[model samples]
Target: MGGGPDKEHVLITLFDPEPKDITGELRRRFPHFEVTYVQVSPSRKDAEKAGNEISDDLWKSATILITLFTLPAKPELVPK
Candidate 1:
């Protein structure tokens, strides 16, 4: 699980261009790592839609979590 790209899972939970853009760049730079975007909001809009896109399985497998303001209400929801 602590291995390199093959075991690494990158979870992008940032706003706007960051989540969308960084996911693409990371996928290009490290094809072996599982890179995904969650399109997290700043609590202004679309948080629910983005939250639905992320599953508990995805959260559990995430080795690297890049996020801004979006976070789960309970830490248990996104255990590392």
Candidate 2:
């Protein structure tokens, strides 16, 4: 594999339709990023519930978030 960033990034993706193509490309470009994908229904309830189930450490460590409409159960779950 080709080299990438000096420091790894924590990237999280929440997409109703899923992001298989983009995730593959992202991994190719930035192999060092720790990427996690959680597929959820378009409904807000499902998205929020899925968000709540994720570990606090993951939410706290996330440096990038790619979300269509999903969000953490609480605003504070996101890192500052």
Candidate 3:
């Protein structure tokens, strides 16, 4: 409970069909950091219907997060 500010949590999201590959890339890029991949299916009617509300929930819990996209020019998708 007293790890200090040096210990921070980072949340990352990928807006693409292949979350695994995106996550792997992140790991490679940031070898010293710990990464957790959240898989969300846009094709899922139930999830798509919920929209940003779900993303908002995840963003609230994240400390320092980054969203990696399949298309480099498509803009990095943040949790917000």
Name model 2 segments beyond 4 Å from true: 1-5, 8-10
Tens-digit lDDT string for candidate 3 (29-69): 76754565554444544344333434554444445655433
Q: Write the per-residue lDDT of candidate 1 for residues 6-34, one digit (tens) a residue.
A: 77887778776654565678788988888
After superposition, the stretches of candidate 1 with alpha carbons farther than 4 Å from their true spots are 1-5, 17-21, 44-53, 77-79
**Judged by lDDT, which candidate is best?**
1
How many residue pairs clash per model? 0, 0, 0
TM-score of 3: 0.36
Clashes of 2: 0
Worst 10 residues of 3 by lDDT: 70-79
Ordered from best to worst lDDT, the candidate numbers read 1, 2, 3
